[model samples]
Target: MVENRPWMTFFTHVVLILGIALLAFPIWVAFVASTHTLQTLLNPPTPLLPGGEFFENYYRALTEGAKAVGAPVWSMMVNSLVMALGISFGKIAISLTAAFAIVYFRFPLRKFFFWLIFITLMLPVEVRILPTYEVVADLGMLDTYPGLIVPLIASATATFLFRQFFMTIPDELVEAARVDGAGPLRFFKDILFPMSRTSIAALFVILFIYGWNQYLWPLLITTDESMYTMLIGINRMLASGDSQAEWQVIMATTMLAMLPPVAVVVLMQKMFVKGMTETEK
Candidate 1:
């Protein structure tokens, strides 16, 4: 549309196409591996085109699972779903309430608490893993759903996102609600929440991906095979020091692990875009 500059437009398209190809290359390799026989995949420059055994590989992964790690793919996927949903909803709920209070109320040490959260952002999970594990162990949370999800749910990023959005809301809306005798809870339910739907959707997409892709925390917390997430279980499938790695099944599971997050992003793309635009304004 800006269009007197055809060369600029053509260059832009070339760059985008190359970017897409680069991003898609790895996925294409994985997908091709999923369709191949294991022996063929192990050998040489590997087949670029897909071969037979696609259904056989996927069926084995979903049903019987890896021989050594026999936890079903379905079970692992369910566990992952539970963890991801728990984290996303838990973070959104707690973050919204905390942000509301921080933005709207006059409380002692509120600024202190805000800065404390920001400080935690600098101290990532990797840094405090030991102390956090100790606290979880003391609380009898280890190897449980609470162990897997609870610590990760209280995100500084989510809290800040909500706080910034809340600040953008005009004071007049709250004043009008107060004039109409609306209590804080009532005003939040009837007004603020409705306006925050897009933000929530956007956050859901990001948080779901964050939770779903978590490897280190989940690996540390859940000791039980039954509690293993898809990501963790997929790693289990890849290779034991004893057995040859099942490239076909592993690739299939990788593709499966990729699905729910991709589905969430694709489905919520419009709301995500709208939220990003509106929140910035």
Candidate 2:
């Protein structure tokens, strides 16, 4: 038997609405600011409603970009999209294979290798960036998509997570695959891959955002304006050294940058929840 309290239900709904408002308020303000002129935004107290300059502001941003950033907003967004997708897929693929080998392969020093990969979690990007940059420079990958994505693609966290999930898969399944005369790759392709869909969805969302927001590595490696990502381009767009900032264009760019990640989350919300919460495979 369950007791239903009307007041508690009402309070819960109130809290949920307030939390949503608090989070959404800033995004709403940004959208409104993006629809106005620089001069209009310069005045104190931003407008609550969207202004009339919606298409003009967005058109200028997509085509002309800001004065400080020479590249068009669309180009920067494309670069970000490429980098984010590459990093996400690359990390997931590599992590999945790495975890597969670690769990199933019986090679000597297997535990040692797994520990080596796991130890890397302690070394954040800042710590090994210099060496990584040198290696990338040596390979002549600077200003290329490979340069932006390759070094950052190897993720210990994803590897560890996939390994844990692989460990949960019953030995009976492995025996069944073997009984069916399936090879290593076939077993993985038929069984493990399909079973890991939800986990992959969750990781894809997270890794996509991580790659999309990467600033320091891309900034350091990319000298060409065409190769700049949304974050780098936005950073460059900030006014400095006696130059006046264009808040409308910046706001418009910000809004545009937010769309892809939001779409990914919305589309994958169900799988992401299952991946995070569901324990039994």
Candidate 3:
């Protein structure tokens, strides 16, 4: 056992190092590119390290194309934030209500309702995109915030996750609450909600990332430049045929677009891990 321990340690280090490189490479590349000038980035061969023109590139990206549909990266960022937050909050609320109903209430066809939602998990958004777009259009939500938010509000995954987590809580706790004359609403508010904080945090991180990185749906729903999300804005920036595309600007905008999801992950890393582990338990 003592002799074998050294081999195990060596293999563990090798695996960890490889994992770190796999995770860090893209982030390092993005950071380095964000600092390069357009000329440097677009040169015959791009340099691998940070360049001196980071602030200049960021400034030009923000101020250069004022009249363009997705110009002023800040506006696009704000639009993305509003849309992401709306979808995250709305999805969580809906999921919580649905999960609670399924878990705590005895009603007809409850299992059927859950099965229907589970079916949605098997279906990709792409498969339903055309019909969903038609619904949005008919509702007069096209090119609007409602169009962007409403389609994402019904997250079957969140509901399923919450239901599974809620199920793990001991029935005795809920029974104790009821025995004390606490109603269902009071039990949920005082006991269930507080107990599920870690799971909720995990779900929030997942949902926020989903909303932030969404591309195709937002692109299809929003035609108005003012309402464009950051992903759409970045795509539009890339598509523009100008004298020369600003690689630095593109990278900077990309980095800015990534910040919120990164922040969410960093801030909630502990809660996210705890939530996943606890739910499994």
Candidate 4:
């Protein structure tokens, strides 16, 4: 039994409410700015409430896109979707395969090989951007879907996660499969892969967000405006060099950019939570 501290409970509730408001304030301001016209937004002290131009602003943003840089919000969304899915699935596939090989196999220098992969965690993409760029250029993958998707696919974090999970599986499962005349590939496909669904779902949410929010790598590789991601496209919407910025359209694009990631988190939340709890335990 616990003591009833009504004042403490009330204080905790107040703090939580304040924290929620603080976090939600940015999205609120963005939504408000999105509904108003450029002239209205440019005026000092922007409106606290939504405006009537909601449909008009979103309609124009969706169809026409920003004044010049973007082709269409829909097209950019398609591009972002492709990139995000590609990165998520690509990383998961390669990482799973690599983890299986490392965890299940006995080979010469196995620890060395594992250590080599682990070392990559210390070196981020930013650190190797120059070398990675040169290699991509050599492979003629620049300005292509392969360019945007491939470079970001090989993830040390994903490998580490999958490897740790694979290690946790009972060796009896592998022994039983061996006794039943099941080879490694068959065992992985029928047993291990199916068992990993929740973990994969959790990883998907993480990788999808990472892929969607990628700005630097994509900006470096994609020279074509058509390949610009929603993040890049959003940045382009801002008029630079003393010109009055398009606050309304930029805010709308910001909101649109947030939708996919937020939706992914909301939809996969249960699976994500379950997987994380199981993984931790």
Predicted structure with the largest TM-score when compared to the true one: 4
TM-scores of all candidate predictions against the true structure:
0.89, 0.90, 0.86, 0.92
Q: Candidate 2 has which clashing residue pairs, if any?
A: none
**Cα deviation in Å at residue 100, candidate 3?**
1.3
Cα deviation in Å at residue 168, candidate 3? 2.9
lDDT of 4 by residue, 1-281 (tens): 17899998999899999999999999999999999999998887999999999999899888878775657788788889999999999999999999999999998888897788778878878898899899999999988999999888877778888888898899999999999999999999999999988789888877888889999888888878788889888877774446666788888989999998898778888866764564445
Q: What C-alpha lDDT, on a 0 to 100 scale, does residue 41 get in candidate 1?
A: 81
Which portions of model 1 miss their true places by more than 4 Å? Answer: 1-15, 271-281
Candidate order by lDDT, decreasing, is 2, 4, 1, 3
Residue-wise C-alpha lDDT for candidate 1, range 184-253, written one tens digit per residue = 9998899999998878988887778888999999888887888999999987776566889888888888
Please, what are the lDDT tens digits per residue for candidate 2 over residues 173-270? 99999999999999999999999987898888788878898989999899899999988888888854478989899999999999987887788887
What are the lDDT figures for the candidates, one per model? 0.86, 0.89, 0.81, 0.87
Better candidate by TM-score, 1 or 3: 1
> What are the runs in model 4 whose C-alpha is more than 4 Å off?
239-242, 273-281
lDDT digits (tens) for residues 17-92 of candidate 3 = 9999999888778778889866677775767788898787777766653233445888788888888888989998
lDDT of 3 at 240: 67
Query: Which residue pairs in model 4 clash with each other?
Result: none
Indicate the residue-level lDDT of 175 in model 1.
97
Q: Can you tell me which runs of candidate 3 are displaced by over 4 Å? A: 1-19, 63-70, 274-281
- RMSD (CA, Å), candidate 2 to true, equals 2.6
Comparing 2 with 4 on TM-score, the higher-scoring candidate is 4
